[model samples]
Target: MALLNDIDGLQKPDNHYILVLYPGAETYESLKNALAPLISDLIILKKRGFNQIGGYYWSVELYFSSDWKFLAICLGMKSANTLHFCPWCDCSKNEMNTTSKKINKSMDNIKVNYHKINGHTKEPLFHMILLHNWMFDELHILLRITDRLWELMLSDLRRENVNEEIWKEKILLEMKQLKISFQFWYKRNSNNLLHTSLMGPDKLKILRELDLTAIFQSRT
Candidate 1:
């Protein structure tokens, strides 16, 4: 029962957060660096595990608990863990077929309906996507599922006005803002799979001016 903590009056941090659920340790750290700007107002960053005490079911509850602004799931290794029953993923196996394992399993004991879902969902959080390693584990069904989920969530970025330095960093140097960089491939690739080829850790470079300008425009 890891209830939400009221850190800094951010009662339900997910409301104003960019909730990230990652698996591995190192990539988790790197993502932390890239996402420092959105890490405020009691935002949460967790590395979920596959266990009984504080593992899978905990993640399932935390994930489906409430409507969040954005939920980003790092679909690591084709997300083979639950296959059809990723709590992070709302669609079930019977309806989506992508999650049929849930349907095949015994739900009488679990008390979950593997083939059905409630209607009128709040928007899913984050920009779920896959790293380039989609070829590693080699589960074609899971691979396709990950790819679809990635593109489906990315379509909501609202990039129409455009913000170059979308994430932020700042200081004053020799007559200039001594700013650091931010990544935006997560922004670009999020739109469509055809554009996924443009992804790379370095592909998204956002300096301060562009980031601010875009943020400002979104206000109007």
Candidate 2:
């Protein structure tokens, strides 16, 4: 009990905070740079049960206890299909299957039901997802793109003899297909004292520059 209390003390609540929510598993690193400020504060974090596009991080926002806090969702385009009926594993690949229509129908009913019973008491809620000029069908495409990127990144890390040039090209191509562009930046760190601090390692010398979290695939 004493140990738990000590850990709790480090998390002292700051009143009038902005609540930032995010789930675990594949969702952990999605909103990296865009969420740097809120993540630094460490307001609310939750592991959502089976991600939902509109409310994947809603579970995280709900964990906030502050009454005056404002809820801002990153609401990126690919975030919407995180909960849809798609399989992305080795077992399901190269096999013909259909989406879970029943699950789709059922979840829709729940969303509809929840939308009906709404009231505000403590903190005000806000959505950051861009809904303007968005098509209904593109939601699934966005999710697929995210899933593909996740799979590719993991593969690159684990697979043997991964081609750097080819893999980088693939990542860039994926970003291009999604209509996303990446910006580059450079920084000088104190750790580079010897100008050869961390580069002692062979593999760490090179890496892809794609921003996984900030990747936004505009509609084609």
Candidate 3:
């Protein structure tokens, strides 16, 4: 789904417009074909300003926003786990932890080098837009961070020899108390615990209302 939001307009759910909705798998070719019309429109809008009422001409500035995976796919970049993991920079996995590196990538550089770029795999689908205009959704970032923290917490519990059933039960009970629907289940052949995928609001509730410290303290 491609949602168009007016950044200068009202900040509400109703203000957003759906540009395209593709139900198939999100591959580079699929996305490129799906977004072709929208891309053409954007190119025209950028080149020729939109003419409104009363002889007014408004210039449009496009900003692409999505989760990391979708953004990587659209940009024709490698997956986040690759050696050069960052979409915005040439920073490798080793340099990601450092703070001294600067963002030296731009749309011009990517166009000039194409597949030769460290992180980029192919030509970007949205080549009309500048690289700096592409943004990562904040809500997705929060959810990803929450997932990592949850995984680390589970690892710590396992390290302390905490019973899996006990911890799972405690977590479900806490989630229920907080009015957040969560559960744990095992796959057909796997012993790993799979839980319900939480939305932004539910994840926020877990972060703020779910008492993790108390649960950890009470693991007897």
TM-score of 3: 0.85
What is candidate 2's lDDT per residue for 1-220, written digit by digit as tens?
Answer: 0112246463555423344455543222445544577544433232332356775533332222111111112221122223321211112222326453221212223223423322211111212211231123333444455556555654544354544344444545655654455322235663211111212121121224444443231110
lDDT of 1: 0.32
| Candidate 1 C-alpha error for residue 142, in Å | 18
TM-score, one value per model: 0.18, 0.20, 0.85
Model 1, 22-104: lDDT tens digits are 55454434555555554332223333423567544533222223211112122211233333433333453454655333322
The best candidate in terms of lDDT: 3
* Better by lDDT, candidate 2 or 1: 1
The digit string of per-residue lDDT tens for model 3 on 1-220 reads 2225545554676767787889988898888889899888888887897899999997767788899999999888988888987877778988778898876788877866868989787888887788888989888899999989988997787677667778777888898899887888888798776779888888888888888876686467
Candidate 1 vs candidate 2: which has greater TM-score?
2
RMSD of each: 17.1, 19.3, 2.9
- What's the alpha carbon RMSD for model 2? 19.3
Q: Model 1, 60: alpha-carbon shift in Å?
A: 24
Where does candidate 3 have its weakest 10-residue lDDT segment?
A: 1-10
- Clashes (N, CA, C under 3 Å) per candidate: 8, 0, 0
Error of 1 at 65 (Å): 16
lDDT of all the models against the reference? Answer: 0.32, 0.32, 0.82
Error of 2 at 204 (Å): 31
Order of the predicted models by TM-score, top scorer first: 3, 2, 1
